[model samples]
Target: MLRLAALDGQVSSWLDLFGPIVFYLIVWGLVFAGTGLFVGVFIPFITGDSLLFAAGILSAGHSGINIWVLAIGVGIAAFLGDQVGFLLGRHYGRPYLDRRTGAWVQRSIRRAEKFYTDLGWWAVVVGRFIPWGRVLVPPIAGIARMDYLKFVAANLVGALVWGVLLTVTGYFAASIPAVKSAAYVIGGAFILGAIIAGILSWRRNRAAV
Candidate 1:
């Protein structure tokens, strides 16, 4: 059953049968033990957006993993990961960030803290789409000492939406012919522009200082 669905022996029949479930188990195990957050942050940077999108494509297939189930799994993984991150920040990371007192860290943390406060738990939801926002925001929530339940609830919703959206986008992207290339070109251009703008901002700030 699993073999027929995945069509790849390397992925394993059990994986096809309970692969995603297994994945959730392993991912959460790491999170509970406090390593999964590292995986989540760097996986995006290393694999780029394609992997999450691929997961979506997998979910969309006639295979065992449906979109809703995938969404729930990913959501649970992300929430648990962030919860660990929040705990880490509350216990360890936040103290370092707070003590460093460097202007940039201060600025970043202040902005994040302010957002967390003003928006309450919803900031975690909005932060899901923000790249680096996801990385910093949970820690901010922890440092800010926001209600854990509220944070968890918001994190669950945000991760579900973001996970589903990215996967669905990947599905549609694969479906289109020219759109993939176009998306690459557009995304590349946007990144280049952001880099250039960041450089200019740095130079100007340097000059001012």
Candidate 2:
């Protein structure tokens, strides 16, 4: 009876020590996953890579979140987002590719279509790692009439790979003091790059006009 009581107390103590960490992981995981879905599907400007990297950094310490959970959450979000985009393309057809669509959106679709033509289903997997590729591939695939089953399979694999790679990279990189200190700088660089790309795109469109 004494031994049973002692074991129970130890279990309770351990839970007390770790409970908050577990709760934080769950809450943050859901939030990041939701963000992944939103950014993956709707916002071309926001990249999932950065989010995964941030999650990785958060997952580094003893009280940090579980890497696998973060990866899975983000992966699921990406997959669902891609699926929705695919369905949208399937239903809407190629009207979006015409002049009615914005230049940036059209460019993204064209690039993704070229990838699909060159590499077939492999393009879906490879495209997830690329910035515009991630946003454009699914809809292009749907418009191209690619098999839904095959698309889903490739999407899942790509999402999982992307999530794992970026998260793990961030997680390990955070361990380095220099990387940790410069994380903000790296984030700023991403934003700056996005701005530059947008400006260049706008200039190109004006020239074409």
TM-score each candidate: 0.55, 0.61
Per-residue lDDT for 1-209 in model 2, tens only? 35434433443343357674553454344333332333444443234555555556656753646767666666766777678767767888777445336676667667778766656666677666677777767777889899999998988777666655556666777678566446546545644554455456556767998
Model 1 C-alpha lDDT per residue in residues 1-209, reported as the tens digit of each score: 24323332322343566766674454234332322354434334322244445554544454655556554555666667777768877777667456645575566667767656545556677666555556567877777777888888877776665555554555555466455466557545644554455456556767998
Query: For model 2, what is the alpha-carbon lDDT of residue 73?
Result: 63
lDDT of each: 0.56, 0.61
Q: What is the lDDT of residue 167 in candidate 2?
A: 61
| Candidate 1 residue pairs that clash | 15-19
Number of backbone collisions per candidate: 1, 0
Which portions of model 2 show Cα errors greater than 4 Å?
A: 1-45, 62-64, 96-100, 176-209
The deviation in Å at residue 125 for candidate 1 is 0.5
Alpha carbon deviation, residue 154, candidate 1 (Å): 1.2
The Cα RMSD of model 2 versus the native structure comes to 12.5
On lDDT, the candidate that comes out on top is 2
